[model samples]
Target: MLLINCPFCGAREEHEFHYGGQAHITRPADPEQVDDKAWADYLYYRKNTLGLQAERWQHSFGCGQWFNALRCSQTHQFKAVYKMGDDAPEGLQ
Candidate 1:
Protein backbone atom coordinates (compact mmCIF):
# COMPACT_ATOMS: atom_id res chain seq x y z
CA MET A 1 0.00 0.00 0.00
CA LEU A 2 2.18 2.79 -1.24
CA LEU A 3 1.23 6.30 -0.17
CA ILE A 4 1.86 9.57 -1.98
CA ASN A 5 1.51 13.06 -0.54
CA CYS A 6 -0.55 15.58 -2.43
CA PRO A 7 0.54 19.16 -1.97
CA PHE A 8 -3.11 20.19 -1.74
CA CYS A 9 -4.65 17.21 0.05
CA GLY A 10 -2.00 15.46 2.15
CA ALA A 11 -1.01 11.81 1.85
CA ARG A 12 -3.08 9.46 -0.32
CA GLU A 13 -2.82 5.92 -1.53
CA GLU A 14 -0.89 5.26 -4.72
CA HIS A 15 -4.07 4.26 -6.51
CA GLU A 16 -5.36 7.76 -6.00
CA PHE A 17 -2.66 9.19 -8.20
CA HIS A 18 -1.60 9.05 -11.83
CA TYR A 19 2.01 8.89 -12.93
CA GLY A 20 2.80 11.64 -15.44
CA GLY A 21 6.26 10.62 -16.63
CA GLN A 22 9.40 12.67 -16.02
CA ALA A 23 9.21 16.21 -14.60
CA HIS A 24 10.97 19.53 -15.38
CA ILE A 25 10.89 18.90 -19.10
CA THR A 26 10.37 22.29 -20.66
CA ARG A 27 9.03 22.59 -24.18
CA PRO A 28 11.08 24.46 -26.74
CA ALA A 29 10.21 28.14 -26.94
CA ASP A 30 10.75 28.09 -30.68
CA PRO A 31 9.39 24.75 -31.79
CA GLU A 32 9.41 25.69 -35.45
CA GLN A 33 13.09 26.54 -35.32
CA VAL A 34 14.18 23.44 -33.40
CA ASP A 35 15.99 20.85 -35.46
CA ASP A 36 14.43 17.50 -36.27
CA LYS A 37 16.80 15.67 -33.93
CA ALA A 38 16.11 18.06 -31.10
CA TRP A 39 12.39 17.64 -31.55
CA ALA A 40 12.75 13.89 -31.61
CA ASP A 41 14.93 14.02 -28.51
CA TYR A 42 12.34 16.08 -26.68
CA LEU A 43 9.63 13.63 -27.58
CA TYR A 44 11.53 10.39 -27.00
CA TYR A 45 14.41 10.95 -24.64
CA ARG A 46 14.35 10.90 -20.84
CA LYS A 47 16.96 10.51 -18.13
CA ASN A 48 15.78 7.21 -16.72
CA THR A 49 17.77 6.98 -13.52
CA LEU A 50 17.67 4.08 -11.10
CA GLY A 51 18.12 6.16 -7.96
CA LEU A 52 16.43 9.45 -7.12
CA GLN A 53 14.11 10.70 -9.84
CA ALA A 54 11.90 13.72 -10.19
CA GLU A 55 8.43 12.95 -11.55
CA ARG A 56 4.98 14.41 -11.94
CA TRP A 57 1.88 12.92 -10.36
CA GLN A 58 -1.78 13.90 -10.36
CA HIS A 59 -3.82 13.48 -7.21
CA SER A 60 -6.84 12.27 -9.08
CA PHE A 61 -8.80 10.88 -6.12
CA GLY A 62 -8.08 13.80 -3.85
CA CYS A 63 -7.70 17.42 -4.89
CA GLY A 64 -7.02 16.53 -8.54
CA GLN A 65 -4.00 18.79 -8.43
CA TRP A 66 -0.69 18.01 -10.11
CA PHE A 67 2.56 17.99 -8.13
CA ASN A 68 6.15 16.91 -8.38
CA ALA A 69 7.94 14.37 -6.23
CA LEU A 70 11.53 13.42 -5.73
CA ARG A 71 11.43 9.66 -5.38
CA CYS A 72 13.78 6.77 -5.30
CA SER A 73 13.06 4.64 -8.34
CA GLN A 74 14.34 1.45 -6.77
CA THR A 75 12.82 1.83 -3.31
CA HIS A 76 9.79 3.96 -4.17
CA GLN A 77 10.60 6.32 -1.31
CA PHE A 78 9.26 9.82 -1.81
CA LYS A 79 11.70 12.43 -0.58
CA ALA A 80 9.72 15.59 -1.26
CA VAL A 81 6.44 16.81 -2.71
CA TYR A 82 5.57 20.23 -4.08
CA LYS A 83 3.07 22.03 -6.26
CA MET A 84 3.53 21.87 -10.02
CA GLY A 85 4.71 25.42 -10.63
CA ASP A 86 6.75 25.88 -7.46
CA ASP A 87 10.49 25.37 -7.35
CA ALA A 88 11.51 21.98 -5.99
CA PRO A 89 12.34 21.86 -2.32
CA GLU A 90 16.04 22.42 -1.60
CA GLY A 91 18.59 19.54 -1.83
CA LEU A 92 16.42 17.72 -4.32
CA GLN A 93 18.04 18.63 -7.60
Candidate 2:
Protein backbone atom coordinates (compact mmCIF):
# COMPACT_ATOMS: atom_id res chain seq x y z
CA MET A 1 0.00 0.00 0.00
CA LEU A 2 1.12 3.53 -0.66
CA LEU A 3 2.11 5.68 2.28
CA ILE A 4 1.73 9.44 2.43
CA ASN A 5 3.29 11.66 5.06
CA CYS A 6 0.93 14.14 6.62
CA PRO A 7 2.63 17.26 7.83
CA PHE A 8 0.72 17.11 11.09
CA CYS A 9 0.19 13.35 11.47
CA GLY A 10 3.33 11.69 10.20
CA ALA A 11 3.15 8.91 7.60
CA ARG A 12 -0.12 7.12 6.94
CA GLU A 13 -1.74 4.92 4.35
CA GLU A 14 -2.73 6.71 1.16
CA HIS A 15 -6.35 5.74 1.69
CA GLU A 16 -6.46 7.91 4.77
CA PHE A 17 -5.90 10.99 2.66
CA HIS A 18 -7.72 12.77 -0.12
CA TYR A 19 -6.28 14.41 -3.21
CA GLY A 20 -7.16 18.11 -3.49
CA GLY A 21 -5.79 18.82 -6.92
CA GLN A 22 -3.05 21.18 -8.17
CA ALA A 23 -1.75 23.74 -5.73
CA HIS A 24 -0.80 27.47 -5.89
CA ILE A 25 -3.49 28.47 -8.29
CA THR A 26 -4.39 32.09 -7.87
CA ARG A 27 -7.87 33.49 -8.13
CA PRO A 28 -8.60 36.74 -9.89
CA ALA A 29 -8.02 39.78 -7.73
CA ASP A 30 -11.35 41.24 -8.84
CA PRO A 31 -13.76 38.57 -9.93
CA GLU A 32 -16.26 41.05 -11.39
CA GLN A 33 -13.62 42.42 -13.73
CA VAL A 34 -12.58 39.08 -15.14
CA ASP A 35 -13.95 38.06 -18.51
CA ASP A 36 -16.04 34.96 -18.91
CA LYS A 37 -13.23 33.02 -20.53
CA ALA A 38 -10.78 33.93 -17.79
CA TRP A 39 -13.24 32.93 -15.09
CA ALA A 40 -13.89 29.65 -16.83
CA ASP A 41 -10.18 29.01 -17.20
CA TYR A 42 -9.58 29.59 -13.53
CA LEU A 43 -12.33 27.21 -12.56
CA TYR A 44 -11.74 24.48 -15.14
CA TYR A 45 -8.08 24.45 -16.09
CA ARG A 46 -5.08 23.08 -14.24
CA LYS A 47 -1.50 22.24 -15.09
CA ASN A 48 -0.93 18.61 -15.84
CA THR A 49 2.74 17.81 -15.45
CA LEU A 50 4.64 14.59 -15.84
CA GLY A 51 7.41 15.55 -13.44
CA LEU A 52 7.46 17.12 -10.00
CA GLN A 53 4.22 18.93 -9.24
CA ALA A 54 2.98 20.81 -6.22
CA GLU A 55 -0.40 19.54 -5.04
CA ARG A 56 -2.84 20.02 -2.19
CA TRP A 57 -3.87 17.09 -0.04
CA GLN A 58 -6.05 16.58 2.99
CA HIS A 59 -5.38 14.13 5.82
CA SER A 60 -9.02 13.21 6.13
CA PHE A 61 -8.63 10.14 8.31
CA GLY A 62 -5.71 11.46 10.31
CA CYS A 63 -5.19 15.05 11.39
CA GLY A 64 -8.00 16.37 9.22
CA GLN A 65 -5.66 19.09 8.07
CA TRP A 66 -4.74 20.28 4.63
CA PHE A 67 -1.17 20.35 3.32
CA ASN A 68 0.90 20.74 0.23
CA ALA A 69 3.20 18.17 -1.26
CA LEU A 70 5.81 18.17 -3.93
CA ARG A 71 5.34 14.92 -5.80
CA CYS A 72 6.45 13.27 -9.00
CA SER A 73 3.45 12.75 -11.25
CA GLN A 74 5.03 9.94 -13.21
CA THR A 75 6.47 8.03 -10.26
CA HIS A 76 4.03 9.14 -7.50
CA GLN A 77 6.92 9.81 -5.14
CA PHE A 78 6.51 12.56 -2.60
CA LYS A 79 9.62 14.68 -2.22
CA ALA A 80 8.33 16.92 0.53
CA VAL A 81 5.23 17.60 2.62
CA TYR A 82 4.41 20.94 4.20
CA LYS A 83 1.62 22.65 6.06
CA MET A 84 -0.85 24.89 4.34
CA GLY A 85 0.14 28.56 3.99
CA ASP A 86 3.80 27.62 4.56
CA ASP A 87 6.38 28.03 1.85
CA ALA A 88 7.59 24.91 0.15
CA PRO A 89 11.16 23.83 0.80
CA GLU A 90 13.79 25.67 -1.22
CA GLY A 91 14.77 24.06 -4.56
CA LEU A 92 11.66 21.84 -4.52
CA GLN A 93 9.81 24.36 -6.67
Candidate 3:
Protein backbone atom coordinates (compact mmCIF):
# COMPACT_ATOMS: atom_id res chain seq x y z
CA MET A 1 0.00 0.00 0.00
CA LEU A 2 1.08 3.54 -0.62
CA LEU A 3 2.33 5.50 2.36
CA ILE A 4 1.87 9.28 2.44
CA ASN A 5 3.77 11.60 4.73
CA CYS A 6 1.57 14.25 6.17
CA PRO A 7 3.15 17.66 6.46
CA PHE A 8 1.68 18.20 9.92
CA CYS A 9 1.69 14.64 11.31
CA GLY A 10 4.60 12.95 9.57
CA ALA A 11 4.34 9.64 7.71
CA ARG A 12 1.19 7.55 7.75
CA GLU A 13 -0.75 4.98 5.76
CA GLU A 14 -2.38 6.15 2.55
CA HIS A 15 -5.84 5.48 3.87
CA GLU A 16 -5.39 8.11 6.53
CA PHE A 17 -5.22 10.79 3.87
CA HIS A 18 -7.75 11.83 1.26
CA TYR A 19 -6.77 12.70 -2.30
CA GLY A 20 -8.04 16.15 -3.23
CA GLY A 21 -7.13 16.13 -6.90
CA GLN A 22 -4.67 18.37 -8.79
CA ALA A 23 -3.31 21.32 -6.82
CA HIS A 24 -2.47 24.93 -7.73
CA ILE A 25 -5.60 25.48 -9.75
CA THR A 26 -6.20 29.19 -10.03
CA ARG A 27 -9.80 30.20 -10.10
CA PRO A 28 -10.81 33.05 -12.34
CA ALA A 29 -10.76 36.46 -10.77
CA ASP A 30 -14.19 37.38 -12.14
CA PRO A 31 -16.39 34.33 -12.03
CA GLU A 32 -19.54 36.10 -13.14
CA GLN A 33 -17.89 37.46 -16.26
CA VAL A 34 -16.40 34.10 -17.21
CA ASP A 35 -18.03 32.48 -20.22
CA ASP A 36 -19.63 29.05 -20.16
CA LYS A 37 -16.62 27.41 -21.79
CA ALA A 38 -14.23 28.96 -19.33
CA TRP A 39 -16.36 28.01 -16.39
CA ALA A 40 -16.77 24.46 -17.71
CA ASP A 41 -13.06 24.14 -18.27
CA TYR A 42 -12.37 25.36 -14.77
CA LEU A 43 -14.75 22.79 -13.29
CA TYR A 44 -13.88 19.78 -15.45
CA TYR A 45 -10.43 20.17 -16.88
CA ARG A 46 -7.37 18.97 -14.96
CA LYS A 47 -3.71 18.44 -15.68
CA ASN A 48 -3.79 14.65 -15.10
CA THR A 49 -0.07 14.58 -15.65
CA LEU A 50 1.90 11.34 -15.68
CA GLY A 51 5.12 12.54 -14.07
CA LEU A 52 5.73 14.75 -11.04
CA GLN A 53 2.37 16.19 -10.04
CA ALA A 54 1.19 18.49 -7.31
CA GLU A 55 -1.85 17.28 -5.40
CA ARG A 56 -3.83 18.26 -2.35
CA TRP A 57 -4.27 15.80 0.47
CA GLN A 58 -5.86 15.83 3.88
CA HIS A 59 -4.73 13.80 6.87
CA SER A 60 -8.20 12.62 7.68
CA PHE A 61 -7.28 10.10 10.35
CA GLY A 62 -4.55 12.12 12.00
CA CYS A 63 -4.47 15.87 12.51
CA GLY A 64 -7.20 16.47 9.94
CA GLN A 65 -5.02 19.02 8.29
CA TRP A 66 -4.69 19.79 4.59
CA PHE A 67 -1.48 20.00 2.59
CA ASN A 68 0.09 19.68 -0.83
CA ALA A 69 2.51 17.09 -2.16
CA LEU A 70 4.52 16.59 -5.26
CA ARG A 71 4.24 12.93 -6.21
CA CYS A 72 5.17 10.90 -9.22
CA SER A 73 2.01 9.69 -10.84
CA GLN A 74 3.75 6.79 -12.57
CA THR A 75 5.62 5.51 -9.49
CA HIS A 76 3.53 6.89 -6.61
CA GLN A 77 6.69 8.30 -5.11
CA PHE A 78 6.47 11.59 -3.30
CA LYS A 79 9.10 14.20 -3.98
CA ALA A 80 7.97 16.88 -1.55
CA VAL A 81 5.33 17.66 1.06
CA TYR A 82 4.23 21.06 2.31
CA LYS A 83 1.39 22.35 4.41
CA MET A 84 -1.50 24.35 3.02
CA GLY A 85 -0.92 28.14 2.91
CA ASP A 86 2.81 27.43 2.89
CA ASP A 87 4.80 28.55 -0.14
CA ALA A 88 5.49 25.66 -2.48
CA PRO A 89 9.15 24.80 -2.85
CA GLU A 90 9.04 24.86 -6.65
CA GLY A 91 6.58 27.76 -6.89
CA LEU A 92 3.86 25.41 -8.07
CA GLN A 93 1.55 26.59 -5.31
Candidate 4:
Protein backbone atom coordinates (compact mmCIF):
# COMPACT_ATOMS: atom_id res chain seq x y z
CA MET A 1 0.00 0.00 0.00
CA LEU A 2 1.12 3.53 -0.71
CA LEU A 3 1.96 5.59 2.34
CA ILE A 4 0.74 9.17 2.18
CA ASN A 5 2.29 11.69 4.48
CA CYS A 6 -0.47 13.71 6.06
CA PRO A 7 0.47 17.29 6.79
CA PHE A 8 -1.07 17.07 10.25
CA CYS A 9 -0.86 13.39 11.11
CA GLY A 10 2.45 12.40 9.54
CA ALA A 11 2.74 9.35 7.32
CA ARG A 12 -0.31 7.15 6.94
CA GLU A 13 -2.07 4.80 4.59
CA GLU A 14 -3.60 6.21 1.43
CA HIS A 15 -7.11 5.14 2.41
CA GLU A 16 -7.24 7.67 5.22
CA PHE A 17 -7.10 10.55 2.79
CA HIS A 18 -9.33 11.60 -0.08
CA TYR A 19 -8.12 13.07 -3.36
CA GLY A 20 -9.53 16.57 -4.02
CA GLY A 21 -8.19 16.97 -7.56
CA GLN A 22 -5.81 19.62 -8.91
CA ALA A 23 -4.94 22.48 -6.57
CA HIS A 24 -5.40 26.21 -7.24
CA ILE A 25 -8.33 25.61 -9.58
CA THR A 26 -11.00 28.24 -9.17
CA ARG A 27 -14.49 28.24 -10.61
CA PRO A 28 -15.60 30.97 -12.98
CA ALA A 29 -17.55 33.80 -11.36
CA ASP A 30 -20.09 34.33 -14.18
CA PRO A 31 -21.62 31.01 -15.12
CA GLU A 32 -23.97 32.35 -17.78
CA GLN A 33 -21.26 34.48 -19.36
CA VAL A 34 -19.03 31.42 -19.70
CA ASP A 35 -19.41 29.54 -22.94
CA ASP A 36 -19.81 25.77 -23.30
CA LYS A 37 -16.10 25.34 -24.09
CA ALA A 38 -14.99 27.11 -20.94
CA TRP A 39 -17.52 25.20 -18.87
CA ALA A 40 -16.33 21.92 -20.31
CA ASP A 41 -12.70 22.83 -19.75
CA TYR A 42 -13.32 23.64 -16.12
CA LEU A 43 -15.44 20.58 -15.47
CA TYR A 44 -13.63 17.91 -17.46
CA TYR A 45 -10.13 19.12 -18.23
CA ARG A 46 -7.23 18.09 -15.99
CA LYS A 47 -3.44 18.04 -16.24
CA ASN A 48 -2.41 14.44 -16.39
CA THR A 49 1.31 14.87 -16.00
CA LEU A 50 3.70 12.03 -15.44
CA GLY A 51 6.18 13.70 -13.13
CA LEU A 52 5.59 15.71 -9.96
CA GLN A 53 2.08 17.16 -9.69
CA ALA A 54 0.45 19.57 -7.29
CA GLU A 55 -2.80 18.17 -6.00
CA ARG A 56 -5.29 18.88 -3.24
CA TRP A 57 -5.93 16.27 -0.58
CA GLN A 58 -8.14 16.14 2.47
CA HIS A 59 -7.09 14.56 5.74
CA SER A 60 -10.52 13.12 6.32
CA PHE A 61 -9.62 10.97 9.33
CA GLY A 62 -7.37 13.55 10.93
CA CYS A 63 -7.60 17.37 11.02
CA GLY A 64 -9.99 17.34 8.05
CA GLN A 65 -8.41 20.33 6.39
CA TRP A 66 -7.65 20.60 2.69
CA PHE A 67 -3.94 20.66 1.88
CA ASN A 68 -1.62 20.56 -1.08
CA ALA A 69 0.64 17.65 -1.87
CA LEU A 70 3.56 17.32 -4.26
CA ARG A 71 3.32 13.83 -5.56
CA CYS A 72 4.62 11.78 -8.42
CA SER A 73 1.85 10.61 -10.70
CA GLN A 74 3.82 7.75 -12.19
CA THR A 75 5.00 6.23 -8.93
CA HIS A 76 2.29 7.53 -6.59
CA GLN A 77 5.01 8.79 -4.29
CA PHE A 78 4.54 11.93 -2.26
CA LYS A 79 7.50 14.22 -1.86
CA ALA A 80 5.94 16.94 0.29
CA VAL A 81 2.71 18.06 1.93
CA TYR A 82 1.66 21.53 2.94
CA LYS A 83 -1.41 23.46 4.02
CA MET A 84 -3.68 25.27 1.59
CA GLY A 85 -2.23 28.75 1.98
CA ASP A 86 1.34 27.58 2.30
CA ASP A 87 3.64 28.32 -0.60
CA ALA A 88 4.37 25.45 -2.88
CA PRO A 89 7.85 24.47 -3.98
CA GLU A 90 9.40 26.18 -6.99
CA GLY A 91 9.19 23.14 -9.23
CA LEU A 92 5.50 22.39 -8.63
CA GLN A 93 4.08 24.84 -11.14
Candidate 5:
Protein backbone atom coordinates (compact mmCIF):
# COMPACT_ATOMS: atom_id res chain seq x y z
CA MET A 1 0.00 0.00 0.00
CA LEU A 2 1.13 3.54 -0.70
CA LEU A 3 1.43 6.13 2.02
CA ILE A 4 0.58 9.77 1.45
CA ASN A 5 1.83 12.51 3.70
CA CYS A 6 -0.87 14.95 4.57
CA PRO A 7 0.48 18.44 5.11
CA PHE A 8 -2.05 19.03 7.87
CA CYS A 9 -2.10 15.62 9.57
CA GLY A 10 1.22 14.04 8.70
CA ALA A 11 1.37 10.67 6.92
CA ARG A 12 -1.56 8.36 6.36
CA GLU A 13 -2.84 5.57 4.12
CA GLU A 14 -3.45 6.52 0.54
CA HIS A 15 -7.06 5.46 0.75
CA GLU A 16 -7.77 8.24 3.22
CA PHE A 17 -6.94 10.85 0.68
CA HIS A 18 -8.87 11.89 -2.40
CA TYR A 19 -7.12 12.70 -5.64
CA GLY A 20 -8.16 16.21 -6.72
CA GLY A 21 -6.54 16.06 -10.11
CA GLN A 22 -3.98 18.46 -11.62
CA ALA A 23 -3.26 21.67 -9.73
CA HIS A 24 -2.64 25.23 -10.96
CA ILE A 25 -5.31 25.09 -13.63
CA THR A 26 -7.42 28.22 -13.60
CA ARG A 27 -10.79 28.86 -15.17
CA PRO A 28 -11.66 31.77 -17.36
CA ALA A 29 -13.19 34.81 -15.75
CA ASP A 30 -15.91 35.16 -18.36
CA PRO A 31 -17.69 31.87 -18.99
CA GLU A 32 -19.65 33.24 -21.93
CA GLN A 33 -16.51 34.40 -23.71
CA VAL A 34 -14.84 30.98 -23.46
CA ASP A 35 -15.20 28.85 -26.55
CA ASP A 36 -16.42 25.27 -26.43
CA LYS A 37 -13.02 23.90 -27.34
CA ALA A 38 -11.34 25.82 -24.56
CA TRP A 39 -13.97 24.74 -22.06
CA ALA A 40 -13.64 21.12 -23.12
CA ASP A 41 -9.85 21.33 -22.94
CA TYR A 42 -10.05 22.73 -19.44
CA LEU A 43 -12.57 20.16 -18.29
CA TYR A 44 -11.35 16.97 -19.95
CA TYR A 45 -7.68 17.39 -20.85
CA ARG A 46 -4.77 16.74 -18.54
CA LYS A 47 -1.03 16.53 -18.94
CA ASN A 48 -0.79 12.95 -17.53
CA THR A 49 2.95 13.10 -17.23
CA LEU A 50 4.91 10.13 -15.97
CA GLY A 51 7.43 11.37 -13.41
CA LEU A 52 7.21 14.21 -10.93
CA GLN A 53 3.60 15.27 -11.29
CA ALA A 54 2.20 18.20 -9.33
CA GLU A 55 -1.33 17.43 -8.21
CA ARG A 56 -3.95 18.56 -5.76
CA TRP A 57 -4.92 16.21 -2.94
CA GLN A 58 -7.38 16.41 -0.09
CA HIS A 59 -6.90 14.95 3.37
CA SER A 60 -10.39 13.60 3.75
CA PHE A 61 -9.76 11.77 7.02
CA GLY A 62 -7.49 14.34 8.55
CA CYS A 63 -7.51 18.12 8.89
CA GLY A 64 -9.47 18.40 5.64
CA GLN A 65 -7.29 20.92 3.92
CA TRP A 66 -6.53 20.81 0.21
CA PHE A 67 -2.81 20.65 -0.47
CA ASN A 68 -0.38 20.11 -3.28
CA ALA A 69 1.82 17.06 -3.72
CA LEU A 70 4.69 16.15 -5.94
CA ARG A 71 4.17 12.52 -6.73
CA CYS A 72 5.66 9.99 -9.07
CA SER A 73 3.04 8.43 -11.29
CA GLN A 74 4.85 5.15 -11.95
CA THR A 75 5.82 4.13 -8.40
CA HIS A 76 3.36 6.31 -6.49
CA GLN A 77 6.11 7.92 -4.50
CA PHE A 78 5.65 11.39 -3.10
CA LYS A 79 8.52 13.81 -3.35
CA ALA A 80 7.09 16.71 -1.37
CA VAL A 81 3.93 18.05 0.20
CA TYR A 82 2.85 21.64 0.69
CA LYS A 83 -0.25 23.59 1.49
CA MET A 84 -2.17 25.66 -1.01
CA GLY A 85 -0.93 29.24 -1.72
CA ASP A 86 2.66 28.18 -0.98
CA ASP A 87 5.43 27.91 -3.47
CA ALA A 88 5.70 24.56 -5.29
CA PRO A 89 9.44 24.24 -4.69
CA GLU A 90 12.16 24.52 -7.33
CA GLY A 91 11.73 21.25 -9.19
CA LEU A 92 8.00 20.69 -8.99
CA GLN A 93 6.97 23.61 -11.15
Candidate 6:
Protein backbone atom coordinates (compact mmCIF):
# COMPACT_ATOMS: atom_id res chain seq x y z
CA MET A 1 0.00 0.00 0.00
CA LEU A 2 0.99 3.60 -0.50
CA LEU A 3 2.59 5.38 2.44
CA ILE A 4 0.95 8.81 2.56
CA ASN A 5 2.33 11.69 4.55
CA CYS A 6 -0.21 13.72 6.47
CA PRO A 7 0.65 17.36 6.95
CA PHE A 8 -0.83 17.49 10.45
CA CYS A 9 0.10 14.02 11.66
CA GLY A 10 3.22 13.17 9.71
CA ALA A 11 3.79 9.98 7.69
CA ARG A 12 1.13 7.28 7.80
CA GLU A 13 -0.23 4.40 5.81
CA GLU A 14 -2.59 5.11 2.94
CA HIS A 15 -5.34 3.18 4.70
CA GLU A 16 -5.36 5.76 7.47
CA PHE A 17 -6.39 8.47 5.05
CA HIS A 18 -9.15 9.13 2.55
CA TYR A 19 -8.71 10.32 -0.99
CA GLY A 20 -10.60 13.56 -1.65
CA GLY A 21 -10.20 13.60 -5.39
CA GLN A 22 -8.47 16.23 -7.61
CA ALA A 23 -7.55 19.49 -5.95
CA HIS A 24 -8.06 23.19 -6.86
CA ILE A 25 -11.58 22.82 -8.19
CA THR A 26 -13.63 25.97 -7.86
CA ARG A 27 -17.37 25.91 -7.52
CA PRO A 28 -19.57 28.17 -9.56
CA ALA A 29 -19.90 31.70 -8.23
CA ASP A 30 -23.68 31.44 -8.33
CA PRO A 31 -25.19 28.02 -8.06
CA GLU A 32 -28.62 29.14 -9.15
CA GLN A 33 -27.25 30.78 -12.27
CA VAL A 34 -25.35 27.66 -13.29
CA ASP A 35 -26.91 25.45 -15.93
CA ASP A 36 -27.43 21.70 -15.56
CA LYS A 37 -24.53 20.79 -17.82
CA ALA A 38 -22.10 23.12 -16.12
CA TRP A 39 -23.04 21.91 -12.69
CA ALA A 40 -22.76 18.29 -13.76
CA ASP A 41 -19.36 18.87 -15.31
CA TYR A 42 -18.11 20.56 -12.16
CA LEU A 43 -19.22 17.62 -10.07
CA TYR A 44 -17.83 14.82 -12.23
CA TYR A 45 -15.15 16.07 -14.59
CA ARG A 46 -11.56 15.39 -13.52
CA LYS A 47 -8.21 15.46 -15.27
CA ASN A 48 -7.34 11.82 -14.36
CA THR A 49 -3.81 12.63 -15.43
CA LEU A 50 -1.37 9.83 -16.14
CA GLY A 51 1.76 11.31 -14.56
CA LEU A 52 2.14 13.73 -11.67
CA GLN A 53 -1.17 15.04 -10.33
CA ALA A 54 -2.31 17.13 -7.42
CA GLU A 55 -4.93 15.61 -5.13
CA ARG A 56 -6.73 16.39 -1.91
CA TRP A 57 -6.55 13.92 0.95
CA GLN A 58 -7.88 13.68 4.48
CA HIS A 59 -6.23 12.14 7.51
CA SER A 60 -9.34 10.36 8.66
CA PHE A 61 -7.87 8.03 11.23
CA GLY A 62 -5.39 10.55 12.57
CA CYS A 63 -5.77 14.33 12.85
CA GLY A 64 -8.82 14.37 10.60
CA GLN A 65 -7.40 17.31 8.71
CA TRP A 66 -7.36 17.80 4.96
CA PHE A 67 -4.26 18.38 2.86
CA ASN A 68 -3.00 18.41 -0.71
CA ALA A 69 -0.32 16.24 -2.23
CA LEU A 70 1.58 16.18 -5.48
CA ARG A 71 1.96 12.56 -6.51
CA CYS A 72 2.57 10.50 -9.59
CA SER A 73 -0.48 8.53 -10.56
CA GLN A 74 1.51 5.88 -12.39
CA THR A 75 4.19 5.37 -9.76
CA HIS A 76 2.12 6.20 -6.66
CA GLN A 77 5.00 8.26 -5.40
CA PHE A 78 4.37 11.50 -3.58
CA LYS A 79 6.57 14.46 -4.40
CA ALA A 80 5.21 16.89 -1.85
CA VAL A 81 2.58 17.26 0.84
CA TYR A 82 1.19 20.49 2.23
CA LYS A 83 -1.62 21.70 4.41
CA MET A 84 -4.89 22.90 3.02
CA GLY A 85 -4.95 26.39 1.42
CA ASP A 86 -1.19 26.24 0.79
CA ASP A 87 0.01 26.54 -2.78
CA ALA A 88 1.71 23.57 -4.36
CA PRO A 89 5.51 23.53 -4.39
CA GLU A 90 7.28 25.48 -7.12
CA GLY A 91 8.77 23.57 -10.08
CA LEU A 92 6.36 20.70 -9.39
CA GLN A 93 3.27 22.57 -10.49
Best by TM-score: 1
lDDT of 4 by residue, 1-67 (tens): 9888887778888888999998867789998999999999989999988888899999897778789
What lDDT score goes with residue 51 in model 5? 82
Candidate 1 lDDT, tens digit per residue, 1-93?
998888888878999999999998889999999999999989999989999989999988788888999999999999999888877888877
Q: TM-score per candidate, in order?
A: 0.94, 0.93, 0.88, 0.80, 0.86, 0.89
Q: Which stretches of candidate 2 lie over 4 Å from their true place?
A: none
Cα lDDT of all candidates, in order?
0.90, 0.93, 0.86, 0.87, 0.87, 0.91
lDDT of 5 by residue, 1-93 (tens): 888989878889988999999977878788789999999988899999988888999998777889999888988889999988777888565
Candidate 2, residue 3: CA error in Å? 1.4
Q: How well does candidate 6 match the true structure in TM-score terms?
A: 0.89
Residue pairs in collision within model 4 = none
Clashes of 4: 0
Cα deviation in Å at residue 92, candidate 5?
3.2
lDDT string, candidate 3, 1-93, tens digits: 878888777889998989999887879999999999999989999998888888899998899988989988999998899877665686543
lDDT of 6 by residue, 1-93 (tens): 778888877889989988899988889999999999999989999998999999999999989999999999998999999987888999997
Cα deviation in Å at residue 54, candidate 2? Answer: 0.6
Worst ten in a row by lDDT for model 1: 84-93
Model 6 misplaced regions, further than 4 Å: none
Q: Which 10 residues in a row give candidate 3 its minimum summed lDDT?
A: 84-93
What does the lDDT read for residue 53 in candidate 3? 89
Candidate 1 Cα RMSD (Å): 0.9
